[model samples]
Target chain A: MAPRKQQEIFDATLRLVAEKGYDGLTVEGVAECSGVNKTTIYRWWPSKAALLGAALIEADVLGFDPPDTGSLRGDLVSLVEAVTRLLTERPSGDIAVAALAAAVRHPELDAHRFFADRFAREREIFERAVRRGELKESADPMLIVDMLAGAVWMRAVFRGLRVTDDFADAAVAALLDGI
Target chain B: MAPRKQQEIFDATLRLVAEKGYDGLTVEGVAECSGVNKTTIYRWWPSKAALLGAALIEADVLGFDPPDTGSLRGDLVSLVEAVTRLLTERPSGDIAVAALAAAVRHPELDAHRFFADRFAREREIFERAVRRGELKESADPMLIVDMLAGAVWMRAVFRGLRVTDDFADAAVAALLDGI
Candidate 1:
């Protein structure tokens, strides 16, 4: 299938997942919603889980590595802003939620590892901050990253609020300074 | 059914919801797991959503109201610690994730409202802190609460980390003074 057509299928898959949750999504449903042939979808991917995983990767939903801005705060703010935009500006957040739910339900899936790797990569920003003496030596980079990202995710995804730049700034400030 | 037995049924419901996504869970499964009569469950709850909602309420998963501690940091520390304990000390987090997924997949469900009310109640702690002049008058209580709770939830729930008292203290310090 053409890349554009593949994108359409992914878009449809995410849309359905967003609207129906992961359990409600199916290959037939994706084909129907995307106007793509079911056989074509199967030709590319073997199962629903594989299709969903591929769609997530193709959509770059969980992919991010914000460039360092020479300061921890700047990097975090930029990174969070990008994440906020990614989760809120499109169907990526829904895709992520579906993937998370699916991972929990089906422990055999690789989606858990994929997200864990993404989170580990996210922690590197904080690791850099610690190395630059921008953070306390005792600070757990993983915890700090979790707190910052968690705040954004909770507000935007769970609480259904628009994650403003000001919120991101405050979050980074809280992480760097205390609150 | 006896209240104590009702608790067992609720426990079973949550356990199944946690292990299987909401879509994979069924009332029959819950009945089989709990050894409760299906008719008895049906008598108390009208639908699967209702059953799940009741199970959550009975489990008291998101239920908590941190008392005033004369300072914003103290109050937040207490609040986040309690939330951490709630999500970590038991299977409540999985139940919560299941309910969240169900709510998202089924828009008509009342789980969203239930959690929204819980979040609103959580905001009250910040409201009290602001009233006591421990926090800035300009502070958005909702955002503050979101960040604080988000950090804990993200760590204990999503990342599957044990949220220690020390970490909670640091979170509060960051929120109060800036990290």
Candidate 2:
């Protein structure tokens, strides 16, 4: 089967898992939802964990659109806005928040790699900013990324705080000052 | 039932839930862990969710034994160190992280109020410094606190980063210099 077919099946499976807890998702359900065969699903992923994990890593949950703005500050503003937009948009943010909550319960077989693309992107963004001299040379990209993303995640998942342009500005400014 | 007894039962439940996911926990399990009667467990807290939420809030997971050091930088250093110590202490952090994870999936019933402490203490520290004139009057305490805790939590929970004194200092320095 083409990888696009695999992507289609994975997308459907994510929606199923997000809507219905992981326990509620099934290969049959995914196949039924996506018009893909169960055999095709199994052939690509050894377990449901693998299938879902791959989707989170590859699928743009945040669609984490990277900023090409001339400076790190602009990049940060752009990133926060995108993140705020993603969280405000239905289903994507809900799925992500739900998935993170679920990941802890099944730490042994979490459907997403805690160490994959998302984390990597965070590091890369900060490092790139440093390279561009957008931030101080001493700034640790990893820590900066963690602070920015962490605040957003905490607000969305814990406080259920709505993101606003003012919020985005404060958070970006905090990053500017805190960095 | 004494509130203290209720507190103990809740503590036991939290540890149990952390060590053994929600599926593995029970009222009887908490009773066994805390040496309280099964009757008392239900008497004070009607549901596991209520018990857990109360325990999570009262346990002071984010409590900081700040050193009251004279300087804002020093105070923040002390705060970060305390946070790191708490995170590394054991089942407390583990259970706190676990409960938060669970809360996301079961949002309706889960009202983990860890952020209440986080934000409160955060504002207190920054505002105190502002009053002392150690920090800019314009400094946003909420933003500062978010940046500090956000960096630590993101590293500890998401990235599995072993937060060290060095990391904390770097974070503090980054924030101080940025401002």
Q: Which one is best on DockQ?
A: 2
Candidate 1 interface RMS = 2.5
TM-score of chain B of 2: 0.85
**Which parts of model 1 are misplaced by more than 4 Å?**
A1-62, A127-133, B1-16, B24-47, B54-62
TM-score of 2: 0.88
Writing each residue's lDDT as its tens digit, candidate 1 over B52-164 gives 87776655444566567877777778877777776776577667766766665565556645657676676777677767777667666666677777788677656565677
- lDDT of candidate model 1 versus the reference: 0.72
Give per-residue CA lDDT, model 1, range A38-146, as digits (tens).
9989999898888877776665444577558888889888877876876676567766766666655554445645546667667777678888988776766666666
lDDT of 1 at A62: 46
**Local error of candidate 1 at B72, Å?**
3.0
Model 1 Cα displacement at A109 (Å)? Answer: 2.4
Candidate 2: residue B65 lDDT (0-100): 49
Model 1 chain A lDDT-worst window of ten: A106-115
For each candidate, what TM-score against the reference?
Answer: 0.74, 0.88
Expressed as tens digits, the lDDT of each residue in A24-128 for candidate 2 is 777889889999878878888777777777776766443565677776777777776766666567767766765666666656445336445666665656777
